[model samples]
Target: MPPYVPRPIVVDYEEACRIRDLSPKASATLSRRCLQGMIRDFHGVREGTLAKEIEKIKDKIDPVTWDSIEAVRKIGNIGAHMEKDINVIVDVEPEEAGLLIGLIESLIEDWYIARQQRAERHAAIQALAAQKEAARKAGPTQGAGAAQPNP
Candidate 1:
């Protein structure tokens, strides 16, 4: 997890990792919650349901990424919501859970890490521009070997 990521999201992601093999369902649930928190914090889209919130960002994000988010939501749904028949037990494979975790990791990189890097780059450019402007305003300086004007 990136150091810039919020503690809540990191906690959920870590918990998901801790139990991914032991309980894929629980892990998926945690991943789902983590995704929701990210959407809320990063995108500022807090709808009634995760699905609705995701829909709001469909045009904002790339199609492939949107599809991945939908996939996570659907797969996580299995663990989050109960089926009509209480007796039935639908299992989520460990591989599927791992996929969810991988998606979360990718999102953290794509969203938070990428944004921070971009901001830093922009700031650096601004600082460089400021330095150049200052130097330009100060005018050219004469070299030590250059002839000095007669007093």
Candidate 2:
């Protein structure tokens, strides 16, 4: 939301959007929910230190995904508390609100897709490594060992 002028450096992306009547869309909501779902699926953060937990495993996430997720999170905070404009919240515009929603949706989608791709890659690597380890352990088979299959 851009129409509402901010108080100095203070920023409230959510509230700004609301004041300007640019509330988030259903797709944005769905995307945000999906991202939340991932958080839930990975770690049942039912209570404290959710950010720390996510940070602890941050390296496991793709950098782009992580960035997008963080951006959406920041914007979400602004949107959710935009109306709470006090010493705590910031102001925004309807246009800014729409942008935030779009950004949120895109980021969430990227996080989901990137995470899946990475998981698959990791699984494949593990499988290949396991196969190699097994082959090494098996060595040359019995008489085949005596024959010296390779120089």
Candidate 3:
């Protein structure tokens, strides 16, 4: 499949990917921030540290997804803390950072885009069903004139 594009926070995710090669730490930081934002925006997880917020939303998501999110959280924790002290060093390979970026993209799609698409599809199906029900009640439009011949 093509690259995953999250409808929300697309720029932040994209920027994280863009900076992956140059600075894995920065990329991971961005990915972590994106996850925090997603939890707050989508799940209404507004309180506590990111780890705690994840706990609040964890049960709602599947085990596998939650695991992946936690992995990103771990990487992000290291990246975020390194900024506080010069002696605190966390090593994250480029590929590891990329994985976090990938996770963020998937979360965006799974959490936001897919839900939106499902809602739209449900609305369309309901409309069609309503139309069909109306047609059935109308009883084939009696006396609307005979079938027209093709010219």
Candidate 4:
């Protein structure tokens, strides 16, 4: 089955990867946007900047995952807000930009796709159990001499 990435998130991530080699800066910017959107959509965090939102949910996610998220935020910020006067031109290498895209893909799979698959499995199990139960209930009455034979 296809992965469960949201349409908007998919669009950004795809665009980011598409231009990763030619335009690392733009890729990083899109990656940052994708990360922000994922946090909002998956974790239901809708406040402050990406960094602040991540900080709010630091305890909810694994420490390693949290750190990765912060890294992307910092790098993306540099790419997004280049300042000429400050002379802050952070270079986003193609490999680094690829990592950002990778992180987004992982988040989509881990958070959205896995949850959805689990829910579907749970529902299927429940349905099968219900069917078996109904069949068991009917079996006792329909067999042998439990009821009068039809003429």
In terms of TM-score, the best-performing candidate is: 1
Clashing pairs in 1: none
lDDT of 3 at 100: 92
Q: Which one is best on lDDT?
A: 1
lDDT of 1 by residue, 102-147 (tens): 9999999999999999999999999999998997798766777545
lDDT of 3 at 125: 100
| lDDT: worst 10-residue window of model 4 | 140-149
Task: Return whichever of 1 and 3 wins on TM-score.
Answer: 1
Candidate 3 wrongly placed segments (more than 4 Å): 1-8, 83-88, 142-151
True-structure RMSD, every candidate: 2.5, 11.8, 4.8, 3.6
Tens-place lDDT per residue, model 4, 56-120, is: 88999999999999999988987788576786566889999999989988988888888989999
Model 3 lDDT per residue over 53-112, tens place: 988987899999999888888888787875576876778889989899889878777877
Clashing pairs in 2: 1-93, 1-96, 1-97, 2-93, 12-90, 14-78, 14-79, 15-82, 16-92
- The Cα RMSD of model 1 versus the native structure comes to 2.5
Error of 3 at 57 (Å): 1.0
Q: How many clashing pairs does model 1 include?
A: 0
Q: TM-score for all predictions? A: 0.91, 0.39, 0.82, 0.87
Off by over 4 Å in 1: 142-151
